[model samples]
Target: MKAVQYQNFGGPEVLEVVDIPDPKMFADLVLVRIEAAALNPADLAFQSGAADPLVDSLFPVTPGWDLAGVVEQIGVATAGFQPGDEVIGFVRGQAMHYGTYAERISAEPRQLVRKPRNLSWAQAAGLPLAGLTAYQAIVHGLKVTAGDTVLVHGAAGGVGHLAVQIAIAQGARVLGTGSAASQAFIGSLGAIPVRYGDELVDEVLKIAPVGVDAVLDTAGRGSLSTTQALAAVGARVASITRSSTEYEGAIDVYARLDGDDLTRLVELAEEGKLTVHVDSAFPLGQAAEAQRVLAGGHVRGKIVLEIREEV
Candidate 1:
């Protein structure tokens, strides 16, 4: 199988397309012929060796975390999937010891969910990591509810876009922070778009004078503090991007790909309550270029790598 691998970490140049052996299936894992995979900011951090806490523990890595594929073979103990089943999920960050930038990958059964019939491979590929992160931050971590007001930072990016829709689906009045360029796009997701800069707090106040019920920060700036200051007393505030300072009244959330969460996200997508916005697609051999675009930031949505011609 052809795969993207790097023995050393530096910049996007460190990533290279190479022909590698296929993954061997474990008893509880399924061998997937990868159709598509999505790139995340973490992939760039991992590749550049900046996310040392997450990448230092592993080396000679392949960096993709979200994948959509068809089961080429099933493990002996895997019960819910069979050969040819289309599935999407977060691949274990560690096993990508070589990453999802490959033609084939072996993932644990619990990490995957059936791909929604309504979505294309590109859309499905964009869901796992970003969708799970948003779902967990808004639905699980913050416990967003109907009639609540929620604010999402980086609202035009992959995770932020999903968060906006998920919060709206939960019946919350949503607000999202992005640049002027993405304001209209974010508005299409049912969120009141607030430009993310000096006027963030002021703009939010104008929209919800009483303060919002929850705030989800993905920008990793000190926006969490701003949100805390603007939130209603005892309101939920969380950040998927880890915080440097301990927040007194907010939860710092980093999403994990669990069975239950993946299942629920899939259900929401299949039900049309969730949307996966794919910004771009690259062929497997151009994995490095995919990472380059992701690094430039301000991406409208997720960027995916097409691993198979059919996908």
Candidate 2:
């Protein structure tokens, strides 16, 4: 099998396309014939050694976490899946030993769910990590409800786009912050678009004078503090990008991608309540270029690597 891997972590240049032995399925896992995979900030963080502490425990790593593929073989103990079943999941943590930037991957049965029939491989490939992150942040962490006003930062990026939609689906009145360029796109997701700049707080105040019910900060910088300032008293606020810090009154949440949460995201995608946006894609061999695009950090949605020809 061919994979993009780095023997030593350094920069994106360290990632190389190489031929490696195909993965062997272990009991309670399934061997998937990789169709497509998506790039996450974690992938770049792992490749550039910025996430060294997180990667040290999972080394000689293939960088991707989200994958959409078909089951080519099933391990003896794996149930609810069989050869040729199309599935998608967050392959990290459970299949951390074998990353998604490969021709094949062996993932734990619990990590995957059937890919939505309505989506193409490229779209399905975009879902796992980002979709689950947004779902968990809004539906699980903040517990948003109808008529609640929710704020999302980086509202046009991969996770942010989905976060906006998911909040709307939950019946919350949504407001999203992005660059001036993404206003129309953010508006399409049913969110009132707020251009992020010096007057971000002013713009938000104009929209919700009483403050918002919840805020999900996808842009890690100092947006958490901004979210804190605009939050209602006892409001729920979470950051998928940054670690929690000393914030006076807001509830801080750290996004953790869990199997059960991924399952619910898959169900939502299948039910048309959720959507995954693919901003760009590269072939498996162009893993370096994929990392380059991801590093730019202004993508409207997910960047994917097409690992194999569509079935």
Candidate 3:
């Protein structure tokens, strides 16, 4: 089996593809032949040692969390899935090792969900982490509801774009912030586009004079600083990029792997309510380059590594 691993944390350049033995499977696990693995900012953070103090890492770390693949075999005790099933998962383990940036991975049954039939392998690969982030923040954290005016920061980003669509799906009127160039893309997701920068607050206020009922901050770097002015009194506020402790009245969100939530996202995709836009797809050997592209920022959607030929 070929996998991407890094011996020392530094940059994307440290990643190397090497032939490793197949993962040790157990009765509680499923062996999946990975077809595609999506890249996320956290993949960069962990790889660069930015998350060292908070999360422990084994030296030779395989960095990836989101994957879409076909089941090559299932453990004896595994239920709800079988060999030949197509699945998607956010398979981040307790420690950084044996990630999805490989030809195969061993994931728990609870972390896997049937891939939406409508999405290609690349698109399905991109959904789990970002979709869960937006779903949890909008639905659980902010409690966005119909008729509420919701504001999403970084609306053109990987998580923000999905956050915008998820809010709309929940019946909220959404306003998303992005650069001027992304206005049309933001609008296409059924949200009013507000340009980023100092004018962001005023622009959001212009659309919702009473202030937005909820604010989901997908873009960190002080993006939540405008919460006081942009959100109405007692409005729900959440940030996936920064800690809630850093911002008053803000709930910090960390995406979790839940089969139930992933199932709902699959339903949304099947119903045409949710979609993943693949900004780029790279072969597995180019994991380094894919991470570099994600590090460049301003990516319109998810970037993925095609681990094998799409079935």
Any idea how many clashes model 1 has?
3
lDDT values for all models: 0.84, 0.83, 0.90
Report the Cα lDDT for residue 251, model 2.
47
TM-score of 3: 0.96
lDDT of 3 at 298: 82
Give a tens-digit lDDT track for model 2, residues 106-212: 88887788898888888998988788788888988889899999999899999899999899989999999999899999998889999988899898989999899
The predicted structure with the larger lDDT, 1 or 3, is: 3
Residue 28 displacement in candidate 2 (angstroms): 2.4
* Number of the candidate with higher lDDT, 2 or 3: 3
> Which portions of model 1 miss their true places by more than 4 Å?
53-59, 93-96, 244-247, 309-311
Off by over 4 Å in 3: 243-246, 309-311
Q: Highest lDDT, which number?
A: 3
lDDT of 1 by residue, 92-192 (tens): 65433847888888888888889978888999999988988899899999899999999998899999999999999999999999889999999998899
Lowest lDDT sum, 10 consecutive residues, model 1, at 51-60
- Residue 278 displacement in candidate 1 (angstroms): 0.7
TM-score of 2: 0.93
Q: Report the poorest 10 consecutive residues by lDDT, candidate 3.
A: 241-250
